[model samples]
Target chain A: MSQLKTKHLLGIKNLDREDIELIFQTAANFKEVINRPIKKVPSLRDVTVANVFFENSTRTKLSFELAEKRLSADVINFSASGSSVKKGETLLDTVNNILAMKVDMVVMRHSSPGAPHFLAKHIDANIINAGDGTHEHPTQALLDSFSIQETCGQVEGKKVVIVGDILHSRVALSNIFALQTLGAEVMVCGPATLLPKHIRELGVKVETDIKKALEWCDVANILRIQLERQQMKYFPSLREYSNYFGVNKQLLDSLKKEITIMHPGPINRGVEITSDVADSDHSIILQQVENGVAIRMAVLYLLAGVT
Target chain B: MQKRLLFDSPLLKVTISRLCQQLIEVHGDFSQSVIIGMQPRGIYLAERIKEELESLVAKDIHLGYLDTTFHRDDFRRRDEPITPSQTKIPFLIENKNVILVDDVLFTGRTVRAALDAMNTFGRPAKVELLVLIDRLYSRHIPVEANYVGRKVNTIQSQKVLVELDEKQKEDHIWLITKEE
Candidate 1:
């Protein structure tokens, strides 16, 4: 009967330390499951899950689908473009229609900040927020911490610096909440305009200089520049943002200690990070992607209670 | 809180030693064999048996651990979520004799899940079951252990508790009757 306290994984801020540990520990088991010769389990065979993406995604959608399929669940994929939502139907109507088909879980990514949270309140099925606007991407944070735990042995007592656009990146907020809850010291490094207001209130320090931030941390989770979310130019241009906070090999090699690098992907190469740094040994980007499936599987499996 | 002691440490130790001797007689130096303990509680018995076998035969045996939390048949139908245990199998069991160890064999559903979970690693040459206690007539599946420490018959409302030295002050077996 040991399970997560929360019914819905809306945000990392809603979870405590033990919940995060429970997730990471469960993910360790799923990681072993995926590494086996036959990488499928009949855990959710009797259950059905729907991936409802109101926002466009590449990695997140594919990762959720693969995770659900690997768990042997009946999966239904719905994209916003061709779905009833694009035909002037409300969010609730579209979701209720999906629910009427007897879906046990819904994994959603939306352009609104509290879309999943709102849907969770009105719906009976389990809700997992894949990414909710610029508010939170809980699974990315979970997988990031999971991958860091796999690399550094543990997350507690380690220094993690999230670099780049904080205001427009949901990944940064979730990572901050997750890392801080797990007892890791977190710092945000980026341009002042790109940073969120009152971010220091989150119990993390702000370092505008990327070099100093990289030098003082055990891991740097470099966020990609969310160009689609940018309405006006946050900084002067992409060139200025790259000059200020972009992580490249030369900048990484200049540091005194070697740190693990991570990025929640769909990377804008040569802008937020160079190709060499993304593909370097210091980077765990691909591992993050691989761990994404295990983490999502753990989330879905935990939510789908055991008999 | 009502409990009845079935076996104490001295008797349990003797029974485990007997099981180890039986394993050695069947598996012989255990070079072409592997021992996989069901995770959580069964690991304690598996470790104890491994230690006894090594001491009796003066040879090391390959040991592995398997967790069947995610492979259960009734996972989605349960009222509460089930937390998973770690699965660690460092060596491949392909074409090798495999011994699946557990503390008690009750419904035999766990053994069935273990069999399903083992397919991911590789096909074993053969698989045998070992348990400290066998609950008579309680098996939902037709699983019978190759080596058994003891067998007992119980009603539907009773539960068997196996306390190991790893988690308790001493090793003992208990049968508890739930109060109405």
Candidate 2:
């Protein structure tokens, strides 16, 4: 029996080295289980999980749902589009009502930063922060780290460079913390405006040169240029962004060593990464998606396993 | 920890030889069979048995490993997360005699979980349990090993420890009693 010190998986910052290691080790098991002929496990048969997405999602929602189903958990999905939240219902009220239905766990993806954290303090049921604003997507970081380790052998002593949208990307924040905790030398590379003001405070080297970063890194977790979250034009145009920070095959091949490419997708293909580079053997984007389910399964399994 | 000596090295070698002879008599070259060891400690015992069997029968046997962490009934009710091990049942068990090997058989919960785990890799024609030591009267699910090395009477608080020559310096068995 391996117990996590924290009750809720709110952020990567809240988790220690052992917590991350345990999650990865557990995810390794689930990864094996998912690859089997019969993918489903009877670990969470009696447990019920509620996925409360206050924002729109394609991958995270489906990945969490698949993970819940594979664990044999009773899944009740509550998207804001069809929920009481659209009817001016309070976050607490809606979640409390769901808890009244005997849901044992809540997997939430909110648009507001600290939304899941606030809910975790109030809710009796365990909360897994799917993606909360520009805060932290712990599971995404976990899966990304897991995928990196799976590909490059280990995260320790490896150079991991996160390219594009560091300021607005929750994945960047989480990945930086996770990779650093696992002893990976982490770097943030993007346009100066897209990078956070206090980005260096996160203990990651800030690299504006994509080629330099890519050349140094063993794994490059490229983030999609967030067009939706932009309030104003941070950069001149999409074309300019692509010209400057975009990862393409030509630039990758010029490097001495082949680096593993990753993207938390809905990729602006030509903008951050080209289609050819994304589909190349060096790219592990699909593996990241596959590892996402395993990582989420590990989180749900461990959290639910707690008596 | 207080330890009482049970079967020692010489007795262990004889018992293992006897077990292999019995398996040879029953399985007969083991063409339609696969041996799966319940991990993590069971693997050592399974390897030793496979070694003994191969030397006696003059043929290689299919050996697999199973981890029952995810298939356990007490999964969600446990105090902490159950760390699962490698479950490498490479060959299909469909319509084959599957031998579930373990170091010890006590409450039978592990064997029950192994059965559940085995169901994923297609249905076997038949399944049998083989244990190095079977503690009598401790059965929780009425599981009886077809091939057992030794049968011992144990109290509720007592524990059985089987150390193989592959890992330990010497092959030995110990019945451990807790301090008051």
Stretches off by above 4 angstroms in model 1 are: B166-169
- Report the C-alpha displacement of residue B5, candidate 1, in angstroms: 2.9
Tens digit of per-residue lDDT, candidate 2, span A1-307? 5777887899999999999998999899889899999999898999999999998899999999999999999999999997678789999999999999999999999999999999988989999999999999999999999998899899999999999999899999999999999999999999999988998887889989998998888999999888889999899999999998989988988999988999999888799999999999989999999999999999998888666
Worst 10 residues of 1 chain A by lDDT: A298-307
Report fnat for all candidates as fractions from 0 to 1.
0.96, 0.90
Per-candidate Cα RMSD to the true structure, in Å, reads: 2.1, 1.3
lDDT of 1 by residue, B92-158 (tens): 9999999999998999999999999898899999999999989898988898999999988877778
Give all TM-scores, in the order shown.
0.95, 0.98
lDDT (Cα) of model 2: 0.91
